[model samples]
Target chain A: MDRPASFLDEALSLDDGDSNNLQPWIGRVVLVEDCVETNGAFVLHHLIKRFLSPNLSSSDSIVIFVAFAQPFSHYDRILLPLGDRQGEGVPSKEAKRDIGDMDWRDLVTGLELAWVGGLGFAELGCNLVVQRENKRLIFFDMLMLECPDDGVEDGIIALYGNIQKAVEAVSSLNKNITIMIDDISLLEVAANGSTKDVLDFMHYCHTLTTQFACTIITVIHEDIYSSADHFTLPLQMEHLADIKIKAEPLVTGLAADVHGQLTILNKGSSDGLGRWKSKIRNFHYRVKENSVEYFYPGGRT
Target chain B: MATNKGRTSSFSRNFSAAPTSSIPGLKYGPNGTIFLSSGVPDLDKILGGGFHLGSLVMIMEDTEAPHHMLLLRNFMSQGLVHNQPILYASPSTNPRAFLGTLPTMLVSKDDRSRNTDAEQKDLRIAWQYKKYLGENKPHIEERDGKVEYCNEFDLRKPIEKHLIMGNRVECISLLDCSSLAGFRNSCSKFLSQLPRYDGNITSAGRIAIQSLCAPQCEYFDKEWDMLSFIRSLKSMVRSSNAVAFLTFPASLVSPSVSKRWQHLADTLLSVKAIPDEDKELANLLTGYQDMLGLLSVHKVARFNTQVPVILDATTYSIKLQKRRSLVLECLNQAPVDGSSGSSYGTSGSCSGSSKTGTLDF
Candidate 1:
């Protein structure tokens, strides 16, 4: 398996004209603070695209998306282009031919989805696992399995076991993986509103990142807890994370002028001092049809 | 010898002081203290970045007008958008109707711009520039680019689906409580569940008790029961992270009872509809054609002495804008007519004096 080109460089334009330089995002845990007003879905979408970049070996690179808040069908709509409207606006015959030649589903190999909802993914026409000649897309529906009790603890434990098994299976195939947890609050709900349980699971995830050489991206809605006492889970996750990103609606009231603010903090990187330092950057971002564009708040062409 | 003693004392004090954690459920301001958004950016600005966590904010409404309910709706809607759990206790109103009355999400100018070709072109051009600059540019560029300092929540969109699925709304009807003891029990039970119900997020949930004065007066057979209930509620707020919004109908309660409620609250806001006769005076003073009511911020919780007063006893003309934003502007001039002068003059003295005196000279 060959090492993949860094997608962050192309997607976010983080490259400094040095192709050899790799970002510190790998083998790290990142937590995204998001709210309804400021959606973090776009960031996750970009990250998935980055993981599935064509530079990587199709057989040796894998992407696992755990959908807790939404269904697998919703993600299918987001990640895959609409088939009927594929070449609608192309002016040239050549471009239309290119669209037809593109096999969008083959963009990522070993793509696995764990749908942790009451409704099974099979009902949405998603198979338990797709294992074609060389490519694979596995789907795990927790609701299909019987639980010992209706409590959140049992479900969370089951999820932990399944994720661990998946990681081990992918690692055996010698594939580098990236994991995304759609909403951590769902885990809290599963754990019966206990932050302690969520923290315990996060500790396990942190261990997985360090030991297994994987990247984990998770989102937590900050508005869920109003007081500091209830904020223990996110704060703890923030403390454990190597990188923390916050998504918020533009303060000036979402106007035609700006969409939202993306506050990224690379906590692992530091200045000359021995103390742990962080590089913080704020970007005003707008979601477009094909890409998420982030620019300096007031930057004009 | 005196200098050595002073230095030692200072060192000890520093060591004894506990490290401060960022306040939950509030955004950290440029200054040290944390500010919670009141769902209205302008109101948050006026109240020094919304109300502080753990503070009890009392909204006293004029029974005849009842327009202040809009503010309450805004507060709840803001919570819903932010994904903050709301524990609303109302005596008379149906909770579902209350939810329905909420204004739809505010459509931002940017949402409208997506339809324009020019805006799309500009966005494309901006995208190119962003790719070129990356993180190489100075931080000042980003700072200068910030157009607004306050966060706005769109009321038009439905609350996050998960929150709705999770049963985030804990609506308690005090009207159902047959006895004062039963009411107290229900309140205590509801308050007890709040901390546990809050999942991974640190924000303190919002607790709103509407028409506290009006309802309790009827529910509790004795005045003692009403006072005791309030006392218990105050203690609960003080100990927990929840920010409480207690609304009272000023006309229903006696002056003494109102005073007690005011004393218990950390911040006090009063809203009264401007009488038809006073409309001319309001127009003359504010120079605005559509002045709806008068808002007086009687008290602000003095948590930090260093923090300046966000809103004093300034009387502001409340205008319900097309976008559903509550605009509060200080009366630019004093009332000239003697008949209406006394009423506006006293309330307007705090803010209007400077403008009125300057104009006179």
Candidate 2:
């Protein structure tokens, strides 16, 4: 008998013997809310790995990653096993052996990276992706591109058009596509803090999820927005998302056994018909050297 | 032959002659009503199915906290979606940032396929008709076998491709005016340049002025100039077929000056952040409290005869929900203890009673 091809299935199975009860994430919008005290990169990395894991039989599945806060090289290091080992200053020989023992290498094979904003990072991302075979890269540098004489509307239109083209190019594969926007706040800044424009852009992205049967994951830092006006966008997005996951550091110091908390609110079931009764779960997690461990709040119990 | 001649004369009289409608740019809604969409459907519902043509809408907001800008964005966004030309005059707002605030139109695969299929079918039918009519082509603008009134604008997508392809209507005009005179001049120039007709079909445009007096307060040497500017602006709006929105910073101006401006507008709306003490009281009374602000509709034109004045002067507690839609619940009655107690349990009952006692102030 064959196992189900879902990284969420495998990942949840490792959740302290509460495997069979866990629900799988199909095509949905997941919001990862991060605060100043907590870094959500590790959780995002884990999510990407789960989506790309070899256990998922769908080899054709694609991952479209839009980077704003970080460069391609930064993501490449976080995603690829080779880059991960190199970051650790491990010798090349041991890194090769470690790669064979894990599924991380196969997990990043289907990544398509996009860089928006300055050309410095986009160029760097392009070069990095080009070194690897079958990897796709797209870049939109506002500095180099001439905006319409009228103003930013033309530029925004161009940016959206490029994204549409990229999505269309991969549509033929008929695979489970996941579009991850690393940080929406950066995109808002790039758009000159126009809350409406950003919200509208996300609405279009939401449309794509239904039209193409794709999943979207967006990361937003709550700390960036202080005023009520600034807070509205994130609040609006939280309402729009199907799944809301908030990550914040524990009140105790980082040296404490439990480092942070991950609150997952499944807004609705997989079918979306069961929205009236949604489920919310919390887990205390710790980021180790090469992996992350999720445990109950007060030990295994 | 005698009957046919009579019919021909009647057809020519109706078709060949100019349209005698008094309003030049009147757009008929889905319900065949002469109303313009406020962008947010909920708002449109509240304002008696949208703003009446040639009426001025004035939004007053706290000078320190100008959150009413979001409503203005929604108004402008609706205009763009309907392909209505917008004349945006502001001194502080960045054009790029303003453009960025528009929401994109959702385009599904089915819609794309259906649109293309429909276009091709329309072309074939038009060609056959043209062959039958022979030489007397209609005055309508035809492209790819279909007649279009004006280019449709989709905020959800990038417009560069449409611009590059040509024939897309330039819809937005951003004017950066520093002085009162400059603002008036820009408004006149922008309004004059707007197209009155889209191939014989009447079309309307939107004029939005951000903080009418803020710029004047900074640049104008006298307050009378600001008052005169508002007077001219009111007359201009009344004369033209365009719907105008003017926002004022309440904190910057005196009560009497704002009252005068409010009197000039057809519809007057004020949005203010709830005070901290009231918010805490509300939270204590209601277990789940997220309402952030209060919106008051001081006056509404055209509803003076049809609807009661009391209904027009209602207050709504504004709650921005998770779905991004602004929910405005009418604040009709004072908060009572019993209802709050049942929803919040024992602790809620205790706090609710205390809050109600303090409500006498």
Candidate 3:
């Protein structure tokens, strides 16, 4: 409640930490898809910062990063706060609730979630290196996972086994565990273009979600499957994801002020009756040196 | 960008902790990454200090014209010039023979001086501001010795056979491979020998695979196989000190499949051939006659960083400077009678452009 809630937080309903299940993201599947023009990797980085950063007490969770896209140094560099000067996202100077042109309603879904002097700022991003050192983070560097020609599944099967073992080992700890796949398209590639193998791998990951109080987050290049099961890889993930976050370039074009827009499709979490109601949140975001600025259309300060 | 500084002292980034490499044809970039020139100096500058050492650069070749060959030839030639190991795979029966057509490095010293003289004579100082005003500073191609970071290649003069024969330049004909597996094996074998980045990269390698998904090759129809090949190639290249440049015809493959290839590319570019007698296009832009094609930079690789590089203008007119070395210039819209069209400054910095008519010369 002390930290200022970004539009991304509101979309994922992370702002309301105590209301829903102790942690909404736990026991859920989150899918992020992006195109060539706009990369959605920032979402994964934000998620890592959110769960790992000790400031967010309610959602303090361990992260299992199965990186198919980039190395640890990359995520590490990004997740580290943008030097001493900048704080986590909302600089107190910019957090002044009274920008003449902007309306308070436009800030956070018109839900009266005005900035209550969130001038109390803590810099965004946690030191990934320190987290990994403390054994709270498990990183699988699959950058060199080259499956053999003899059989497609040999390499990926072992990779899945390793992930399962890591998850099981971590699950024993009382903390909520979240498994993150940097991307799935690359997984398909590692599986020698076998969508079946990739799907099988995801199915296995789904089992972990059920067996443990775990959440699964994955990234897939939506543009690849944009036209058509609409790509079986994305199709399966779509079915699995409780929250789907799509990052796409602006409809008009690229701009310096606006990096891209993210659409968060929240397929509501199960209630006592197990009824599902999906809600969609669309907003524009600008990625900065230290933090990401999320605002509504026609509502930037 | 403060983010560039990370949480650490900004000095560590601008001034790299890693000792500068004495290698030729390499430039230091942010995040401890070294960049290899993409052959064409202008192209290199346009793509923000050329391609990163370990990244996948994919060029979507134009369906009607072989414009991508110009890029591929220059990429391989730059590696050869730098004595960097090269593994070139092509659909041709004799990929080595194609190296015979590699352009010779232009005598940069004399030609550059000559070019400056010509520019001073032909282009007035009034219009010369266009170079620095709206665009990134033109990279200083400082030639210290036999090795140059980037060289202006003379397309007319073929590189000496001695240069091609002496270096560790490899050429694999796609016709020889029945499956991508065999080709991937050779690629992996070649990439394995290249140096990797531990603290500092001693040497780097370049891999140029032309027409990777061409129908002439045996694995043309197998979309997933090609995708996996590129995926693995990207992965292999990422760990090693190498740059893998691959070109595939976007028109030849299905849209969805082409999208997959585009997704995998760290740097994605597409080249389109200009029609010979498109009257409207001729009127729309100046210097229509000299243009060979248009180069659109879809994506520029941002290694070890999350920020996306958005170029001022994605499209550029690929014109052969003096009909020799390739030069990419911003499109200059012709001055319509009453409307007074803006010229080369695509970001609407046309205000600074001289009223030297539409003929920017």
Candidate 4:
């Protein structure tokens, strides 16, 4: 990665200069993906640990996705040492039907360990799961299997139905939720849905944002194929996001010996990094925790 | 010269240099000490938290043979350390000596360890790329945290490249002390001409004007009136925020002759020859001590070390002018009797010590 232009670095260092000005949405939600840090999961862990602004309310929540560079099984070992597991007391679907409503703490802890902890929930790698409370809501049940004998139309209907059900469950819980999907492109191809079907899915997402009153964030890889799939997601929805940030490759002095660059992309247009637009005079920027810091030579302040 | 005459005529018409800002590329702080972060802590701190962008920093030593060229060399190292562009003006000393030996000496003594302390977050990526691709031949000292000079070509290009790659610093120094005579000869004509925005001396460049010739010289008399000439030169240096070193021989020029010169300066310090050549370490220690002395005066800057003020037995004599004793007593670290409120002696220390800006070495 090349050093950025001087003006850009200045733009980064130049203080907003307005102290009383309130930036309420600055730390409302953080999107951590695999970029510059370890893998996507490790990036999410770092963001959780280094969330900026110690003043952030506990009520605030982060949305993360472990959507890069490994099979779910591989990440499970890493997550285990960190103390996280998915759905401990709350039964899986089979036991949920057997036992009504498990304790909420169990569900929360379970989700924390799994989505926030376990990092190996979707081992089969086909399903998109949500960890709210202790329960793992399997949003996409069809693990990446070769096309089902029931055919592509049935798969689309099944996929769409599961998504609707998951959205409804998240709304009923009244908890701000982060939905983690593993490579939306894989989901699109797996749905075997026509372009119209995918468009309908995007429209449904818009409806979910309004009806649920919850934040919806997606982590998309910037790979050419995945980016194309991400494009199919509605442009209007992209604008609705409060923030969109990008994580690019970084090279530091100590780590100068390392090889390769890491790139993390956030689908939310309103995240901290995307808000800045170049100006001749001044601009505004909010840095995320663990984000690269650019200091002007004699401390800028 | 004709162009200068045209400019003078134009200036007589319009006072403003241009519609744009006077100090272009200058960034200002609240009280406005120019913050030059060249990514090196030592250089930055040595410069009182970097150069004051719009303030004239005058570096002076007794005129005559020595001049403050060595001090200017130390100053130039700050520019090289950060890899910023330098516009060297060598009219007196050999430019080649500056170009060759100065950088080599700086590079040689540089403990590679210090470079490691730089913001290393980005290097992680570069090294990672090197590891995966097997393209970069990692140097052994890289682990020790040293940034080896990639090559002899303009250091600024690589630094700018690094800055473009996410490292940024603005360092520029001018070695022009030897050119004092030429500049003085040309000043009348140069002043007459409007300073071309596109001229060789851009607004952002650093300037070192060494060997300030004695006022009685034929050159000084023909160029301009003494007082206004001093004021004009000071004004130019101030406007550019250039670190200027004005050299005058202590043996030749009497203090009584130009007490007014000391009046215009913020920090008045003298560089006395150190007796122990080996202990003194030639240019670096002498240069470092004077810089430390100047830094002691500037209230806006904070220093990491308590500077030692020792008179040079070889060059500085208390018996001659008592000037050295006056400065030492004023800035003396320990308490002194009967000298508390004296005009020459200041209660100089780190904090709550004294606000006085005079130091004698």
Best by TM-score: 3
Cα deviation at A247, candidate 4, in Å, is 57
Question: What overall lDDT goes with each candidate model?
Answer: 0.54, 0.52, 0.75, 0.32
After superposition on all C-alphas, the RMSD of every candidate to the true structure, in Å, is 20.6, 29.3, 9.3, 27.8
Error of 1 at A290 (Å): 1.8
DockQ of 2: 0.01
Question: How big is the positional error of residue A44 in model 3, measured in Å on the Cα after superposition?
Answer: 0.4
lDDT of 3 by residue, B225-310 (tens): 88877887888788678999999998899888888888889999999999999987787778899999999999989775676776
The collision pairs in model 3 are A88-A123, A88-A124
TM-score of chain A of each: 0.71, 0.70, 0.81, 0.45
Task: Write the candidate numbers in order of decreasing TM-score.
Answer: 3, 1, 2, 4
lDDT of 3 by residue, A127-172 (tens): 5656776777889998767675556556888888888888788777
In candidate 4, which residue ranges exceed 4 Å CA deviation? Answer: A1-301, B1-30, B36-47, B62-67, B80-98, B104-203, B214-217, B220-227, B241-243, B266-268, B277-361
Give lDDT tens digits, candidate 2, residues B84-173: 677776654454446555544333424553575477456446334533443212111112211121122233344333322232222222
Identify the candidate with maximal DockQ: 3
lDDT of residue A222 for candidate 3: 86
Q: What would the per-residue lDDT of candidate 4 be over residues B1-361, giving only the tens digit for each residue?
A: 2443333234322322232133333322211123333222332322333444323344445343242444455444444543434434433335434444332222332443245334433433443343444311111112221222111112222222332223122221223323233454443233323233232223333444444444434444322133234444544444343444444443443432233344333333455433434432322222223222321221122111111111111122111111111111112232222324322222222342344223422
Which residue window of length 10 is worst by lDDT in model 2 chain A? Answer: A111-120
In model 1, the Cα lDDT at residue B231 comes to 51
Among residues 3 or more apart in sequence or in different chains, the pairs in candidate 2 whose N, CA or C atoms overlap within 3 Å are A157-B158, A157-B159, A196-B101, A197-B100, A197-B101, A239-B322, B104-B155, B104-B156, B105-B156
How far residue B169's Cα lies from its native spot in candidate 4, in Å, is 20
